[model samples]
Target chain A: AQSVAQPEDQVNVAEGNPLTVKCTYSVSGNPYLFWYVQYPNRGLQFLLKYITGDNLVKGSYGFEAEFNKSQTSFHLKKPSALVSDSALYFCAVISDTGRRALTFGSGTRLQVQP
Target chain B: EADIYQTPRYLVIGTGKKITLECSQTMGHDKMYWYQQDPGMELHLIHYSYGVNSTEKGDLSSESTVSRIRTEHFPLTLESARPSHTSQYLCASSEPMGNEQFFGPGTRLTVL
Candidate 1:
């Protein structure tokens, strides 16, 4: 079974500082990785995804992720953090051979302090 | 924002009451999914459909039932609302074999 792991329960960062939300995955074959953000009382919004090619994938709202195949990690990163960037972030994965539905990791709460 | 939409963004109902949470999309997506989420938690898929007249249960076991009678509409029904069913229900749609899905504003259901 394909699964994603977000080790951090919460990450605190100062506004304007670079932020990183760590994610790792386990799958039978090559993996497709994704990141999503959820604000209070709202549905999840897609941030980015890595399907194939390009180890560095950029996403909406000045966010990006680096897919490291050797480390089995796809960490979300931002050049600088904004207070509004504070939200719950989730990492999801789906293997090329397994079930089509994505398996999500426990979300990480990002708190960007001013 | 995605063209998908969910009705009754907030719903409160008594236990044993029958409720149908409506979901519709204007994007004409062939694949639609329903997910249940608790506050500050990862979403769990409850139901999904590839197209009209095709519905399948997801990884999680859910008592709620869903129907896909039209390409644009996929509604989930709870035969008996229970306290355990109180959670946010999200609807999503994507094109055939599309990797990313577009989500609708979730419906928060509180069963008392």
Candidate 2:
């Protein structure tokens, strides 16, 4: 079964500091990993995905995620934290063998202190 | 950009009321999905549609039902609303061969 895990329920970071939100996955074959962000009272917005390519994938709003196959992780990162970047983030995964629907992890709430 | 829209952004209704949440996309995507979410939580897929007149239930069992009568529209209907049904319902559409799914603003439903 393909599954994603975001261990932290919340992550707090000071403004201008680098931020990292941890994510790990379990799947049989090569995994399709994705990150999404959700603001208050808004639907989820896609951040990025790692289908097959470079280990590090850049995404919208100056965010990036690194896919570490050996560690079975795909951690989301930002060079500098911004107050507006605070939101709920989710990690999802799907494998070649399973159904098309993505399995998501319990989300992580990011609070960027101003 | 996304060209997807969901109607009744916020809805409050009494229990046992029959309600329909509307979703439409002009992106001409062939695959559409419906997910239920709680505030600041993970999303659970409740239903999905492959195309016009095609619908399938998702992993999470839902009392609600959906229809895809047209290529551009997919609406979910709950026969009898209950407090447990209260949640944010999201609609997403993806291109035929695209993995990235674009989401709509979502409908926040509350059952009283």
Candidate 3:
């Protein structure tokens, strides 16, 4: 079964500082990784995905994630954090050879202090 | 933005009440999914539909039931609402073989 793990329950960073939210996955086959953001009382918004492309995938809202094959990780990063960027981030994975539904990790809350 | 939509964005009901959460998508996607999530928590897939008339249970065992009577509609029904069923329910859709699944705003259901 494909699964995703987000070790950190929460991450705190000051506004304008670089931020990284860690994510790791386990899949029997090649993994299709994705990142999503959720605001309070709102549904998840898609960020970016890694299929079979370049390791570095740029996403909406000036965010990017690196797909590390050897490490089995896909960590979300931003050059500078904004107060508005604070929200819950989720990491999801689906195996190409397994069921199409995504397996999501426990979300990591991002706190950006102004 | 994705065209997926869910109705009753916030619902509060009493125990044993019957309720149905509605989900619809305008993208003509072939797959639709229903997920249960506590606030700021991980998502649990409760049910999904391949297309019209094709519904399947997901990884999580849910007391709710779902139906896909049309290509664009996938509604979930709970026979008996309980406190344990209180959570935000999310609806999503994706085209066949598509990598990304579009999400709805979600319905926050609270059973008292």
Candidate 4:
């Protein structure tokens, strides 16, 4: 079974500082990775996905993620964090097989302090 | 933008009462799913549908049941509400062979 892991329960960063949220995955074959952000009392919004090619994938809200195949990691990053960027972030992975369903990680709470 | 909608954003019901949480998407995606989440826990998939008249249980065991009678609507029902069922229920839709999913505003339920 495919699964995703988010190591941190919460990450605090000063506004305008760079931020990183770590994610790793275990799958049978090539992985389809994705990042989603959820605001308070709102649904999750799609940030970006990595299906094939391009180890460094750029996403919405000035976020990007690097997919490291050897380490089985796809960590989300932002050059300069803003207070509005604070939200719950989830990393997901799907196997290359036909299932096409996503296995989500335990979400990481990102807090950007002004 | 994909238009996915969930009704009753918040619900507080008594034990043993039957309730249904409605989910609809106008994106015309052929795949829809239901997920249960606690305040700060991992999302657990409870049910999913490949298309109309198709529904399957997901990775997590859930007491609620779901039906997909139409291509765009997938509603989940619980025969008897329980305190353990109190959590946030999210609805999502995606293309038939697509990996990216669009989520709807979750329905928060509290069984008292």
Candidate 1 lDDT, A1-114, residue by residue in tens: 888999999999999999999999999988989999999999989999999999999999999999999999999999999999999999998888856577889999999999
Against the true structure, what is each candidate's TM-score?
A: 0.97, 0.96, 0.98, 0.98
The chain A TM-scores for the candidates, taken one by one, are 0.98, 0.97, 0.98, 0.98
Compute fnat per model. Answer: 0.60, 0.60, 0.72, 0.75
Judging by TM-score against the true structure, name the best candidate. Answer: 3
lDDT of 4 by residue, A1-114 (tens): 898999999999999999999999999978989999988888889999999988999999899999999999999999999999999999998888766478999999999999
What is the per-residue lDDT of model 2 for residues B2-112, given as tens digits with 9 covering 90 to 100?
A: 899999999999999999999999988889999999887789999988898889999899999999989899999999999999999999998643287889999999999
Runs in model 1 deviating more than 4 A are none
In angstroms, give how far residue A101 of model 2 lies from its true place: 1.3
Residue pairs in collision within model 4: none
TM-score of 3: 0.98
| Model 4 C-alpha lDDT per residue in residues B3-100, reported as the tens digit of each score | 99999999999999999999999988999999999987789999999999999999999999999999999999999999999999999999855469
What is the CAPRI rating of model 2's predicted complex? Answer: medium
Identify the superior model by TM-score, candidate 2 or candidate 4. 4
The TM-score obtained for chain B of candidate 1 when compared with the true chain B = 0.98
Residue B71 of model 2, lDDT score: 88
Q: Model 1 — interface RMS deviation? A: 1.4
